[model samples]
Structure formats: C-alpha cells, structure tokens
Target chain A: MKRHLLAVSTAALLAACASAPVVEHSKMTGAEIAQIDAVLKRDFRAKGQAKMTRLEPDAVQRECNLHADNPPDSVARSLQEAQLKTIKYPSDSLLGDWKNGRKIAESGRGMQWNEKPANPGGGGCYNCHQLSPQQTSHGTLGPSLKGFGKTRGYGPDMQRYAYGKIYNAKAYSACSHMPRFGHSGSLSEQQIKDLVAYLLDPKSPVNQ
Target chain B: MLVSGRSVLLTAALTLAAGSAAAQSQFEKYQKMVAEGSPVELFELVGEGLWKKPQGPKNASLEQCDLGLGAGVLQGAYARLPRYFRDVDRVMDLETRMLHCMMTLQGRSLEEATKRLFGNADKPSEMEYLSAYVAGQSRGHAMAPGQSHPREQAAYELGRKLYFYRTGLWDFSCASCHGEEGKRIRMSELPVLYKPEAARPLIATWPAYRVSNSTFKTMQWRINNCFRQMRTPEPVFGSEVVNAMNMFLTVTAQGEPYRGPGTKR
Candidate 1:
C-alpha cells in the first residue's frame, strides 16, 4: 500500500515537474494560494446571490482536489467514515408528505445568486435520475431511483438509507452525483423526510 | 527551545497524519466538459429514419403530425412544444404530445408509446429514437413558441404562477437557481429562466441526446428533474400542471430559436 502511494505521488510529482512552473511545496505556499484567489476574484464577477466565496474550497474539498476523484482506497474509506459521522437521523419515523416530495423532486430552483435569501431550495434530483413515472422530464447525472422503496423494501434500514443518502450522499459513496443535501444545507430535515416518503411511500407514484 | 518545540510539533503532526488520509479526490475533469458541443448528433440519424418508418397498427408515419407547428410541418416545431393544442386544448409537453400523435396518426397504444419514451430501441419503445429524430429537425431554430390562443395564454399564465409557486418540503420554487443569471453549482450553469432569451434556447434544445447515459431525454424529463431538485411532490404523467409549466417556460422563450436532440452534460 505504501509503495503504491509512493508510486502515485511520484507520478504526480513527475507530472507536475514536466508540466510547467515547478511546485516546490507539498502544500500550496501562501503566495501561490493567494495568487489563485486573486485571479479568481479578478476574473469572475459576483452576481446577485452568487458570491466569490463559492470558489473557496474548505479543507475537505482541498484534500479531495489533491487526489483524483478515485483517491487511494484508504483515503476513500476514511473520508466516508468522517462523512458518515456527520449524519443526524430524525428521531421520528421516516415518512412525510409525498405530495411535497413530488414538488421537491420536480423543482429545480434554489440557491441562485438572484434567489431571495428567505426562499428555500430544490433538490434537482430529476436532473440526474428517474424517480417518478408521471414526470417525463429529468436529468441523467445519477441512477434512476424509480422503484427505490419497492425494490429495497420501505423498512427501517431503507428509510435510514434514503434519508441519510439525501442528507449526505458522500457518506454512502464518497463520490456520488447525488448532492450533499444536508451538508450543503440545500434541504432541511423535514424536506429530507418528505423526499424519503416520496421514494418509500407505497402510494407515492415513484413506487407505483 | 525553538528546536525542541519544532520536534514535538513534528512528532504530533506525523502521529495525526496516520489518522486523516481517507479523503477522496475532487474531479475537475467533469466541470471542464460542460456544453462542449453535444454528442447528440449521432442519435439524430437514428431518430430521423424512425420518423417516417411505420411499424405500428395504422401503418402511418409521424410525418403528418403537428408538434405545435400546425400539421405536417417539421420545421422549427420541436422547440415550441408543451403548449396548448386547440383540438386537445390541454397543454402537453413533447412526449405526451407525441404519444397523442402516434396514437392518432401511427395507431400505437398509449401504453406502448409511453413506455417507449424512457427506454431503448426495443419494440414498442421507439420514443427515444423518435424523439431524437424530431428534436434533430429543429437543431438550430430559435424558441418561437406562439401564444396566440386563449388556452395558450392561460397555460402560460399558469406556468408562470407555477414557476414561482413555492410549495414543498424545502419551500423551493423554480426561480431559485434559474431565475438569476451567472449562478452555477459545482460547475453546472443554472440558466436564468426569467430572462426569455436565456430560457428559450434551453427549452428548445430538449429531447436531447445525453451521451453519458446513452438515452434520449424529453423536456418533460428535464422538468421532472427540476422537481426532484425542488424536493416537491412528483407531478403526474401528462398532467395539466406539467403542460402549464411548459407553456409558462415556452412562452417565456417565445422568440428564441429552436435546437434539439441538444447535447447535455
């Protein structure tokens, strides 16, 4: 394992050396980091609600960028463990308003630079996967989650998975197209519950 | 004293390093390729041949169908869809409207055609190819959805109301990301729909060929996705609400050119 890591780092180092200006530090130097920030600030205009801060990568993000999306196995496992620890399940049962779930899944609005600060957001799940039978429009970024509850069984374990997955997909698959709903504060607790009900409720069109 | 402190700090750092190495990589590659000329061109051919070819009960072709462009006119029709039809009156997006056309013109069962919309090129599942073909026809036309009819006007008004209507777990409305220009999440540009110029082109480009998924996606499919993002109740199939939303967006994009079997990231 150590040898493989060494090989990867070596390859990265070699690639870096061959590419352009030499990078001397394992970590970005203060000047280098500052320069990148300055460049972005100059180039990207801040619009309505969209701000320059969106470009800033947190520590975890920085780590992820350092490695390729498929970082070493140890790295994936560790990050997942850390992510899993952050999830907070509801004390009550997982069911909510499926009608609301329909609305949430169908909605593609939220968090725009021009969006009113008080208005909530949409999950934009349909942008990636198939969820309900009725709605024909949807994106293909993620897997079609139709028959989610029927196939998985809308039992306790699954309820947890749906809720948790909606909350933070990184906990399950370190690199899932499904958003980090809770982590990013994109969806609230009740909204997550409603999404769960949408997928798990037998009466919901998704299962039907 | 400085050297002693440095050694202790180094030891602590090494010890802690053993614990935090489990992070995954953030791929920048996916972001760079957005809107890099869609690969739907290949699917366009497959769809075109299927358009006039007949296999259903009526032994007819989709050539005489009206996709919101009067009858038998294929030019720039794909983009101004999901509007109100006088005979049908009710609003319908591309897939549902096509289902009506195939049922009436091609004599296929609604079940067969409806099921075909989401899947591959198997029997009774030609919507994918058909959509690709139809979408290909208006590849570069502007979004010129006409709202001359009263029903069309009504649908547009309803859709406008729906676009801003916030009712769901998250209280999300369509205007959240798309209402604003210059907003992108994780490298995906969220086009502003309030601006007709921006919304029209995108609306016109659906029934696009998604290369990564290798499937044809209708505008209804795109709206369904927006619903997913909104965390709201999934709309019913061929429901008026869906039509209403389409009319809303279509009218907003009234004068933009048409383009379809559009390539999406």
Candidate 2:
C-alpha cells in the first residue's frame, strides 16, 4: 500500500512537471522567496515576543534559503568565519556546574511567543540531542552526546569548542539547524558554560 | 484496501519506532484503546446541530452553503477541497470555505464568525465541530485537493519553497525536523511531510482529536502552532501561507482514502 501510494504520487509529480509550459526548477527563485517574504509580512501579525522582524531572514539565512540550505563551500566557509566573530567568550573557565546544566538540557522551553521575556529560558538540549545514558526520551535530530567527554578527552580545548558551539552553532556549520543560543540572547554565557560542562565534565552523567 | 490500509498504518508506526519495538507496540496499543473510546462522534453530532441551526443576521442555516459541490451536497465534498471556488475566486480549504458560508448564507460578520476559531478541551469551537462533521462525511473517498488551477499551482510552489525556507530566531523551517526521515523531537517521530509515503497516513487523518490536549484541532491551527513554536509571529487565520502548506500536503497525499477526523496523541 505504501509502495502504491508512492507510485501514484510520483506519477502525478512527473505529469505535473511534463505538462508545465515552462520548465521551472524546484529551487526557489529570488522573486518567489521575496513573494513569500511579502506574503509573510502581509499575513503574519505580531503576537507576544514574536515580532514582525522575525519574518526577515539574516544574511546567513538568506543564503541558506536561496541555496536550499546547501550553500556553496566558499560562501559557507566565509559565512561561518563571519558568524564565529559574533560569539563572546567569557574570560574565565568555560565549564560551569553540570547539575544546573542537567536542568537546562531537560527543559524544552525558551524563545517561544508564549514565554515571558523577563523569565530565564531553557537550553532545550534534550529536544534535539541525547546527553546522558539515563534519558531515553532524547531526540535524534543531532548527534548523540552520550560519553561525549569519554570519547573526546576532557581538555580545555574541548571545553572551549563545546562552549563556542553552544554559543553559535552556525560559526561551525553555516546552515546548521541548531539555534544561536548566545548570539540570539536565548542562552547566556553561564547557561552555555553549564551546557558545556553537561557534555564535557568527567562527573557528568554524559561521561558515565 | 482496508486490510492494506491497516498494514500500512502498522508499517508506518513500526518505522517510527525503529529502535524500541516494545515501547512502540505499547504506544500502538494505547493508540488503539484511545481510538476505540474517542468522543469524535459527539463533536460530529454537535456540528450537525450547528449546521442545521438558524443564526446570524440572515437567520438561515448552512444548508444552502455550497462546499464546491452544488448546494446541500455533503458526501465526498471534503475529499476534494482546498479547491478553487469560482464564486470566491480563490483556493479555499474546509475552514476557509466554511467561514465564507457563515458570512454569505448566514450573514455573519467575519469578526463574529472567527472570534473563537480555536477552542480548548472544555469547549470545542464551532469550526472544530463543523470540520469533524464535514470531514467525517468523506470517510472512504479518495483525498483529492485542487492542483489544476493556476492559483493552486502557485500555492503549491510557494508551499514547497516555504518548507525549505529557513527563518526565525531558531533558523528553523519545516525541513528542520520534517526534512529528514527516521528523526524525532523528544520521542515524537517527525514525519517527512514532503514524502508521499510519510504524508499519506498523516494527511489522511487530519483535523484530528488530540488526546494529549483533549482538544479537536484543525489543519489551520496545526500550522499556526508550528509557527509559534518556530518563534515567529502568528499567521492570520485562513491566510495563503496556511492554505498553501495544506495544499502541498494534501496534493502530495492525493488518492489516499480519507480516514479522519481522527484520534491523535
């Protein structure tokens, strides 16, 4: 039945492609993206913390959208370099308490319109990446961080990498799906350092 | 087809639960139990009453309202919706068309009609009940939304682009979670909605009764909540983006038998 459904839709899509007077590529054109932007501006109203400005894509986002999230290597590298400059490294230790990190990792709340601006938001780490061996409900969207410290040695360089990655994931991968926690002000320096400890601390369950 | 349908559903369920067979089966068992005792029929009955009830300025029922079929036709009407309406000169989904009916046939103002578009467990809205009733009327009919119309084609194109168009604080698009198969967000498997196989069962059972929230949800509400989660501004109800996304999903799953207003976790 699944195969039947697949065949039917494939045939339909093919027919649609064949019958078109002008062959249009599946990639989004600039005008169409602009049209979508226009529609969003016209159709979406500001609610709670979600402002009309959220509709506007940043430079990295614009390039990602134009290239379908697979920008050219040179462009992506340059974008990554530009993004790296945005992260603010704390002058002190990169790692914070992992116990606090556990709470942040478990939480999936933050930056949503329903949330209050004054209240501290969660890292929502468990929503995408597995951390400890105990939490089986973790998501598979990101690579698992179980035994993270064990696999990658618990060095200062690793801690710095973890902190920077958590701060702005796009600094490493230009079109990454992960949010820019520090850059976007979703997670503070302390919150990011705590998350770094959650992954890299020897005593953390992630290393167990 | 019914036997095959059940198997297809099972296959999809098991595919989602690839790593944990035991947990998946237990979840499936819970789902079956929930479906058995669903209050969907109650919502449908209430909807029927609302459909027949006389209200608004004209004080006329929705019986005269045409749902892309001739006036008063109910059977199989939903299966072919989000279609282009000649009278309105737009591609409208079920809720959109129903809103048009409330204004035209019953002479209700747009503000009055859409005041409580979404409802909670304690009190489901008129739109929720009405969607259940109308969608139930198309149970066995093949899912066939509009595609031939130039506007519909444009909507589909827009929807396709929107799926991959990453924006917002999280830089998340629909593709962030749903672009890949065999991925999940905290145990809930994200369906790769662009794929026909993934979309078939998912799209077939929409405007569903959500057990977790104890609320009946429409496709429009579904899209609305997703954007909210994406940390973006709220989309106006029944807008082109919402309808266009619906168009993309429905068109992708065309020819699947309508098996909802369904039960969901």
User: What tens digits encode model 2's per-residue C-alpha lDDT throughout B1-265?
Assistant: 3332333345444544434757778677768866876788888899999999999999999988789888989987898888888897888899999999999999999999999999999989999999999989988777778788999888777777787788888899998989888998988889988887788798889989998778889999999999988888998898888988888878877777789989998
- Give me the candidate number with maximum lDDT: 2
Residues B1-265 of candidate 1 have per-residue lDDT tens digits of 3332223323332332211112101122221232344446656676777777875898998888888778878765675565667777676766778788889998888777666355642322466677777766765554545466777777665566455433333334565456556544433557767565576566666667564464667666677667644444345456666777776766666544454556654
Error of 2 at A167 (Å): 1.3
Tell me the deviation in Å of residue B24 in model 1. Answer: 22
- Encode model 2's per-residue lDDT on A60-83: one tens digit a residue: 888888887888899999999999
Query: Per-model i-RMS in Å?
Result: 20.1, 4.7
